[model samples]
Structures are given as C-alpha cells and as structure tokens.
Target: MKLLALDTSSEGCSAALWLDGQITERFELAPRGHTRLLMPMVRELLAERGLKPSDLDALAFARGPGSFTGVRIATGVIQGFAWGLDLPVVPVSSLAAVALSAMEQHQLADGSGVAVAFDARMSEVYWATFACRDGLPAMQGNERVCHPENVSLPDPDTTTDGWFGAGQGWKFVDGMPEAIATRIRSIDTSLVPRASQVARLAIPAFHAGQAVPAEQAQPVYVRDEVTWKKLPGRE
Candidate 1:
C-alpha cells in the first residue's frame, strides 16, 4: 500500500512516503519551526515518489501524548491533506512509535522487554512498559503520565530481565525509582518517532478499516488542562 505519514510531536518534524514496502523520509529538529518545515518536507517526499495527494492509499500521523502544539500541527496537517484528497487517515500514538522504534533497534525478539518514556516538560513523563514480540511492542503495563518519583516497574516475575529502556524521558529522571533501576540494563537515548516508523506502524490500521475522519484525527495531550505560563524566553 502507498501511504504518507508525518510526525511533529517533539523537537523534530518528519514526513515520509511509503510505497510498496519502500520508504522515503525527511526529518529535522526544527523545534517551533514545524509550521514552516512540515509541509515542505511532505511535498518533497511526495514529489520524490512522483505521486499526488490523491495517489496515497492512506495518510498517517503521530497522535500525541506529546507537545500540544506539535501534536495539533501534525494532526491538522494530516487532516488538511486527507480531507483534500478524500483519503483515509490513521492516527498512531507518538509514545507507541517511540517504543516500537526502540524494540526494532535492539532486535528484541518475542521474549525481551523494554520501557518507553518521554519527558512531558511539565515535571512529568509519559510512560509505558512493553513486552517485545518479534521486535513488535506489546504493552505489558499501563500507559500513563506520572512524575519520575511515582513511576513503578512492571512485575519482573511476569517477564524476564535484560530490561531495556528508551526515549528522552529517562534523561529527566535523575535517579530512577528502585523499582526500575535494578533491572534496566540498557538504554537508548537517541530514539524518537520518525515519519518512517509512523507510516510503517500505520499500515495495519489503515488496511484494517480503522481510519477516522479528519476532524477526529486529533491529539493525545496527557498533561493537565491548566495552561502553563511561560516567560518571553520560555515555552
């Protein structure tokens, strides 16, 4: 299937074209510049594939548990593109993409496990523990927003050790709770959701008749509703 996917859920903006199992993607860590970079990246990706918006079988994007503006930017762009072409769209979880990428990185087979987290920027982290199955991430615990201190490890008895962790969220955790620290033996600090991964992950959802309306393709901002005040140099 030919699919176009994009992600603007963090420090980077990324877009990709996936056709016949081949993938072409563009990504950059442009921070607040997502507004400027995203569309161009999408255009370039589509242009390289010699395809128009209508040629895509589906459109996919990272649907939050991330930056409010970033998630909105990603979903809004997907909405416009999908709506314009009258195409279906798949909304994949940003944090889920993070975990999937990590699982792929380690070649973790059906029995290994990993923890995924992302610094939520308001003194919290978006966290989930997954059991890696043939390199695919299957949730082994709950997905939630919690302070570093409140984070707990999943039951070790239910899964084997050689625990791996991924994402930038772990950096914010100074000294991990005793629950997670003892078993976490490896960590990959450089992983984040890329447009390529989002597209790859969305293939199943798109083919399974799981696509949603453009307006319903919204974000999953897990932080509290209280607006965070920032200084001129902040935010």
Candidate 2:
C-alpha cells in the first residue's frame, strides 16, 4: 500500500510516505513554519519516489491535542489531498503517535506503557497513556487536557515500573502527583510526534478498513470545545 502521512501537531513539521513496507520521511522542528513547509515536504517525498498524489492509496495525519493551529493545518492539507485523489484518510492520534515514537526510540517491549503529554499552554497538558501492542500504541484511556497537577495513569495500580513519560508535558512532572511521577520509569521531554510514526500507526488501520472519507476526517482538540477554529473551506 502507498500511504502518505503528515504531522504538524507540535513544534515539528513532517511528511512521510509509506511505500509498500518501507517508510521515508522529512521532518523539521519548525514551530510556526508548518503552513509554509508541509506541502513542499510532501511534494519532495512524492517526487523522490517518482509518484504523484494519484498514486497514493491513502492519506494520514496527526489529528489532534497539540497546537490548535498545527492540527488544523494538517487536517486541511490531508483533506484537500484526499479530495483530490479520492483516497481514504486515517486520522492517527498525536498522543498515540508520540507514544509509538517513544516506544521505538526506547525499544520498549510489548505491553510496556507510555504516558504522553503535550504541554498545552496556560499551565495545562494534553495527556493520554498507551501500551505498546504488537509494535503499535493502544490507548489506555480517553485523551484529556488537564492541569499537570491532575495528570494521571489510567491504571496506576498496575505494575508501574515499565511505564515511561514522553513529550514536552513531562517538563511539568514536578507538579503532578508523586504517585504518578514515581510510577514513570523515566521521562523524555524532548520527544515530539512525527509523521513517520503517524504513517506507521495508520498502515494497519488503513488495511483494517479504518480509513474514512475526507469529509468525515476531522481534527481532535481535547480542550475548549467552543473555541475551535477550523481551516478554510471547512465548517
């Protein structure tokens, strides 16, 4: 399957192509450059592979809980591509993407848990926990946006030694409950979600018939329900 994935959900802007089973990606830590950089990265990836948008079977993106504008940028771009190519789209969770990326980087075993948190300004975080399942992240609970002091593990009672914390949200660990902090084996505050992991997480979903129409694909913002600002052409 030929799938194209993009993620602009954090300070990072990335585009990736999943060709058959091999994945190729271009990523940069360009905080506000996503609007100007994302499409070019997609173009470059497709050009290097001698493929066109029509050649792709599906599109994927990190759909939420990061920078509000960043999520909208990805959603708009993917929706436009999906409409033009008449392809299915897989909306992967930004938190899950972070978790899977952390798992790969740490070489964690299956069942090992990752608590992902994106530092949402105003002293809150976009948080969620996931367990590595067959090399993919399986969410342990609903994604939420909450104060660092309120952050938690879905199953704190379970063995916690295998759990690790990831993302900028970890910067606020000192404010979280001692119980939750103690359970985390360690923390990686430098990690950001990438399109490579988004593509990795979307492949199986695409194959399993989880891909959806462009109109049905939407960005997920875990906080401020009434304040969402969508990209142009979207209601």
Candidate 3:
C-alpha cells in the first residue's frame, strides 16, 4: 500500500510518503512558512518516489491540537489533495504522534503509557495520554485543551512507573504535581509531531477502513475559542 502524509501542527512542517513498507520523509522547523514549505516538500517526496496522487491509497495528516494556523494549513492542504484525487483521508492525532515519538526514542515496552502535552500558548496546553500496545500508541482518553496543572492520568490507578512525559508543555507548565512528575521517566521538550509518525499511525487506520471523505476531514482544535495575540519580543 502507498500512502502520503503531512503535518504542520507545530513549529515544524513535514511530509512523508509510505510505499509498501519503506518510508521517505522531509521535515523543517518553519514556524511561519508552512504554507510555502509543505506543498513543495510533498511534491518533492512524491517526485523522488515516482508516485502520483492517484497512485496512493490514501492521504494522512496530523489534524490538530497544536498551532492554530499550522493545523489549519495541514488540514486545508490534505483536504484539497484528497478532494482533487478522490482519495480517502486519514486524520491522525498530533498528540499521539508525540507519544509515538517518545515511545520510539525511549524504546519502551508494551503496556507503557505516555502523556503528551504540547504548549498551546496563551498559558494553556493541549494534552492527552496513550498506552503503548503492540508497538502502537493507543489514546487512553479524549484529547483536551486546558491549563497544564489540570493535566492528569486517565486512570490514576495505572502504574506510574510505566508513564512518560513528552513535548514542550512540560517546559512551560510550572509546578507539576510531584506524583506525576516523579513517575515520568523522562520529559522531552524538543519533540514535535512529525509527518513520518502520522504516516505510521495512519497505517492501521487505513487498513481498518477508518478513512473519511476529504470534505469531512476537519482539524481538531480542542479549544473552543482560539483567539490569541502575539506578545512583543515573543516568537
């Protein structure tokens, strides 16, 4: 099966092509240039592999819970491509991508849980928890947008030692609960959702027939009111 994926839901913009089993990807930390970079990256990846939009089974993308404009850029692009090619669309969770990255980096075993939090800016975070089962990160609860202090495990009774924290939210959030903080084996602030991870996660969904029409593919901005203004001297 061949699949194409893209993500611009964070500081980075990335595109990936999954052909049979081999994967090819391109990623860039273009906080303000996703619009210019994403399509070119996609075209380049496809050209390198001699694949066309119609040659792929589906197009996948990180749907949301990151930068508002970034998320929209990905959603809009994927929707346009899918709509034009009449292909199915797979929407992967940005947080789950982060969790998957952590799992791959730490080489965690099955049954391990990961808490992924992305700095949502405006003193808030987009957070979620996932359980590593069969080498895939399965979301434990609904993804949420709220203050970091409000972040907690879906099941408090789950073994804390099995939990890990990841993403920039940990860096911005102050005074995290000791119980949660101590249990996290490590926290990676540098990780951002990537298109490669989105493609990997989409494999199962694509086979499971979880894809939707391009028009139905929408961004998942957990926050209701996404209004924010940039502060002076802050990028």
The candidate that wins on TM-score is 2
User: Between the candidate structures 1 and 2, which one is better when assessed by lDDT?
Assistant: 2
Residue 80, candidate 3: Cα error in Å is 0.8
Off by over 4 Å in 3: 156-161, 226-235
Please state the error at residue 75 of candidate 1 in Å.
0.9
Candidate 2 wrongly placed segments (more than 4 Å): 156-161, 226-235
* Model 2 poorest 10 in a row by lDDT: 224-233
Residue 234, model 2: Cα distance from true site in angstroms: 5.9
TM-score of 3: 0.92
Model 1, global lDDT: 0.80
Model 1, 1-235: lDDT tens per residue? 8889999998878998999999899999887899999989988988887888878888899987788888888877887777678888899888778878887777776677778888887688888888776556777766789888887766776466467888998896565687677788888878888888898788877777889876567677766573432222322
Winning model by lDDT: 2
Better candidate by TM-score, 1 or 3: 3
In candidate 1, stretches whose alpha carbon ends up further than 4 angstroms from where it belongs are 224-235
User: In model 3, what lDDT does residue 150 have?
Assistant: 76
lDDT of each: 0.80, 0.89, 0.86
Arrange candidates by TM-score, descending: 2, 3, 1
TM-score of each: 0.90, 0.95, 0.92
